[model samples]
Target chain A: MSTQTDTRSSAVVAGSFEGDPRRYLRGLGGLLVFLLVWWVGAMTTQPSYLVPGPLDSVRAFIDLFATTTAIVVPVSGSDLVLPTGLAHLTETLFHYVPGLLLGASCGVSLGLAMGWNGALDDWLRPLVRVLRPIPPLAWVVFAIVWFGIHHTGAAFIVFVGAFWINFYGAYGGVEGVSTDLTDAASTLGVERDLSMLKLVALPSAAPQVLTGFRTSIGRCWMIVVGAELFGAPGVGYEIINASNNLAMATSVAYMFLISLAFLCMDVGFRLLEGRVLAWR
Target chain B: MALSSESSVDRESREKITVRNVSRAYDSTQALEGVSLSVGEGEFCCIVGPSGCGKTTLLRAIAGLDDPDGGSILVGGDPVTGPGLDRGMVFQEYALFPWRTVRGNVRFGLDRPACDCADCEARVRELIDLVGLDGFEDAYPKELSGGMKQRVGIARALAPDPEILLMDEPFGSVDARTRDRLHAELLDIWAQTGQTVVFVTHDIDEAVTLADRVVVMDAEPGSVQSTFSIGIERPRERTSREFVDYVARIRDELGSPIDTIE
Candidate 1:
């Protein structure tokens, strides 16, 4: 009887797990369909120079596998290979990961600080508003002159793209926290500096914090591609190289790889969020 | 008269909370003005008044959740500038942290504080049972009924083992039956702990049923208009003649049936 009850409850929970699979699965399926259409369209184009067919792209991709830097070096001294698609994604992540970490941490901290202290908000408001409108891409010129095509250059550009989003989201979240929660927390002996932001403000603003993370995650792809297009390192560079040679299929494939990486990141974060706020 | 030597939150053991010439105003509207009262140690003093009669305002001031506009409030001989944990408060809205289970909410005050009291968990369990929540400790506030949520709020207020409990119309949101049940439950908790409590309620029956003394205030710059001693025996019968007499006298003075008070 107990086993039967457990089975029934498990079945109920398993059924509810289908809650938003359509949102993710459909998104995944849609990307595949888009790639199929691109592949077919490239095949129909007779001029190989104008639109390299999927076969030509596959050949180039395979060549990269033969010559690619191996992630795990074997003691046997046999040459190891990585799939071109995966290598390109990893390259993109090199820029994406560090930029996101630095930018998000700084953004959330500064935003919270400003939101919590009215005096600080007053002091920084004018300066932040003036600087906020300048596009992150505008700094690419300086990025080139200073870093000169290094990973740091690409990361700098990526940080510029991601930071503002996190800052704004955290700012809105902190500011939107209810004053009543502050009073509630303080009534229980949690105080001013350690208080509203740490206990009440952060919890009340969780949904907004998630929004900021989502925004920063989305911005990473754009910055990655933009950095590559501007002569910075990564798979964005590969996409530019393929496009210049009119390897339309390879360019399309690289785009799909980056898209897949982003989709996986979104799914991972969503899962983490669901688990963390299980009480909600 | 009891626990006078227990160092209650008063300079004079007669008054647990002293709100002397207290007044508060929001722009032109006065929430309280020249309102003063003394609640004694271990006393279950209920404040009864009309809507917007500053009953909640007075309790908030007593809890140090709000500062009086003009006068002074002293708890244990210390002038309160802001809220302190020495006084625990329960609001009309239940005020239990919705994200926490019943036991979690009750023991929230203990989470951060350094303590060696081995019976802390046992006391929380006792409180949950005392408030009729032993089986519902794992349940969230959203899962509980209105009465149960209020019980959790009461449990939370008592969690810190504060000297006084300030309740603002805590049972007002529940139906009559549930409210009555909670009234009985609250009295049990009070009796068990001997905690000083100042409860705010507009229900005359409720005030007379639970309180040792009922303080009724008039509206518009609200201040005490009258006081009635229940003086009824323990576990007072709501339908008893004395209970009826106290309820009727206050109701008559208020000049309406319960519905007419609206």
Candidate 2:
């Protein structure tokens, strides 16, 4: 009896919405339903100030860009005017970018080293395990004390958040490197430990490393907002200040900004990942 | 047959590889014990055995990918301390670097100073052509079929222009038709490059088809059982009486079919 099916199966499962037009319509439908529910909830609330309508929040979001603020330029020592939303957003980015980049760099390096070297793993594993569970926000007290609630203080919190994610990603990736590959490399005249790691292990571990970095990118943004909540100048500060003033719609607007920023970064990174990991 | 008879006198004088009393053990079980064999220069030698026969282990020792627990393996009068560019290896699984393209994989073994130079690029192109993978130089290993991937493995191994080519069932995974085509292509490559080859396989017909000398092995503390010389000429007719006779003799020498089942 023949075992083959009459028709070939598609790679994507049945009913999958990837690259399909219906998925877009469905997404728009979902957003509309959510907005309707939100609007109904706002009408039922005891005080309208507690739960502003989606329209009010949208107006507040637009106002952020229309308003301008003056700030002293560090390099030029001159006053520069920028849109209110952008002024705070730039301050958040100043710490978020450097913190994620530096922490990810150090974490990946250390993780790769530990994964490759058994002795180093043994030496550092205990310390890492003890420090790993302490939340990034918990370090805020120390950050404020050490860096004086400036960008550096918020940056340190973001760094802590980024470091552990990337560390585990790189560590697990290197640990999972195939012995078959290493043996093949050995036969091909790559014998030294460092050379083996570079020529064989590193490339093999690349997908995992990139995956970890991607995860950290999203996680670090969450940390940035939390870090800014304690009187640091950013969207988080705006969120807290607006809520304290009972301008709840302004707080919701900044929250939406955070989500939009995260979505943009995630989409950009995904495109880059697609290019980098095309072989996979 | 006549050609092999004529060359027999000179074969003893050009011993390229000498494995002298090699022994290896894993934990409690002995994989190989006091096994000794020699291959002449430019010779095509195949080792055939059942599962657990340590054929791959012996091949790995020759490649210097593994160290024998006892005894020594000498290639071209020098002891094999570790893997070197002098010897190239082809694995059954086609262990290609997935991240690298066909061109990149083939260029892996080239000396660092020669990399990215015009000559190096030419050499990579030449190897890709040799393995019949000319148009697929830009393709990744994941994109290739089983036969194509093995071809890339062969091209990558030959990139360094080694003196000895050691293969462990390099065509075992491919289908019968592809395996036959690869066999002919491999023989053609072997003839063009006069490198000594030590191939290992479990297939009797395969060993009969490719090897100038087939060495049969037995498992459970694996050691050599017998050796047979195939005097048949190139492009051997598999259905011919002489070819069938050789296959029968070797199969008989391998012992009962029941012994090989497990």
Candidate 3:
């Protein structure tokens, strides 16, 4: 430890924006190869609907946004016209955003509380163990029965998926906080319990907690699609509905839409994580 | 316990810290046994001993981070029930909060909300300058050298203006040259602040260089073996005959390692 020299703000030279072009070109080359293979598979298939070439999927994707659909607003009792692509995307976000936000918040809070308090941890441990193994999909039956085939029902499944990941992430983080740090805080006039937790343990555990949240961000997207498959109005429904009609290209296009949405969200989340967990 | 009120008042005025027959055992092992010591106001006292001598346990007991199974610790005539702001501690690992910058770590003991107020910022800036880390206020612990980190730790402990400073082998991890520099800086700070400091270390030379009075302890139910007062003046030469004599005498009292090995 003593041998290490100070190496901060010095490793990176100014105005050196040079990044390796070969790596970027290589990634582009890989994508082109994948597209070629997919095109060949589409050509050889007995029916074009069975396999979608990249070009066909792209065309279908464009048509989804170009076309308009009438959506009935339940609260306003009015018919709203929006692009087909946006209507379904909005439906997915309706559940996905709320479910993830609510579940992750509750999970993080409870996990921190339980991890910090020994008696709370003991009391909750058995219940968490029992509930953890039951898959999120297994709750679809209860979600439909309890909330009906509405956005709330689909949101519940997404919530369940997000909750567990964040709980374990926060719990493990708090559990791993070094006792030396807390002892240091205690001597510095910060009392034990909540203040120590907020000032010392929370910051210590932040990297892990944020990593879990990022993981859930991607996971909930996958769960969002699954939740909407059971007659809820969203991109997942469009994918299944198009497939039943043998419009495989449209199904693949909606699948692409989901992928693009997830990518955008993941990138945005990474930027936020970089700012918040800069100390790591 | 039987001391008269008049003598107790004098003791309180003269002594900054008093540990009375403090005993602590961990499960099957006795970590500290009937240890008693007093540190005078504004005194620099170092506890020197071999490994497992409960020097750290005794320091923790004094810091109120740990409680003795039997006996008590008093700071400013008040019984130490738990860790309080009157005493500040520095650890060997330089346990600065990794999430905070050098300025943040130093300002932590101030017990104020992190605000942009002039008074708080000036106090923090003064501490940073005092520790000779003027330009590196925004640097995190991971970006710092071991010496710099320990300096931050020292600054943080001093920020609260505590009456007593407790340190546990705070310079153990730094290189020798850095340790010597830190020794001088610590002495300078001690002179400036006049806070009674109790430092624990295994290095005999460190004890000799930094301590006004060195307390030697022995293992196997750790207890104080003896105490030596160095009459050497400020910035005493390590090579001087008097300084060398004190180190040798303290080493002799510690019992040479060959005796333990045999």
Instruction: Score every model by TM-score.
Output: 0.84, 0.93, 0.92
Model 3 Cα lDDT, one tens digit per residue, A101-158: 9889988888898888899999999999999998887899999999997788988999
* Candidate 2 segments whose C-alpha is farther than 4 A from its true place: A1-19, A71-80, B1-12, B113-116, B256-262
Model 3 residue A101 lDDT? Answer: 92
TM-score attained by model 2: 0.93
Instruction: After the best TM-score superposition of candidate 1, give how far the Cα of residue A110 lies from its true spot, in angstroms.
Output: 1.1
User: Model 2: per-residue lDDT, tens digit, B63-152?
Assistant: 998899999999999999998888999998999999998898998888532455768889998888887777677888877777888888
List residue ranges in candidate 3 displaced over 4 A: A1-18, A72-80, B1-13, B112-118, B258-262
DockQ result, candidate 3: 0.40
Task: Give the TM-score ranking, best first.
Answer: 2, 3, 1
Worst 10 residues of 3 chain A by lDDT: A1-10
DockQ of all candidates, in order? 0.29, 0.31, 0.40
Candidate achieving higher TM-score, 1 or 2 = 2
How much TM-score does chain B earn in each model?
Answer: 0.90, 0.93, 0.92
Q: B58-89, model 1: which lDDT tens digit per residue?
A: 98888777877899998766788888778888
**What is the Å distance of residue A252 in model 3 from its true position?**
1.0
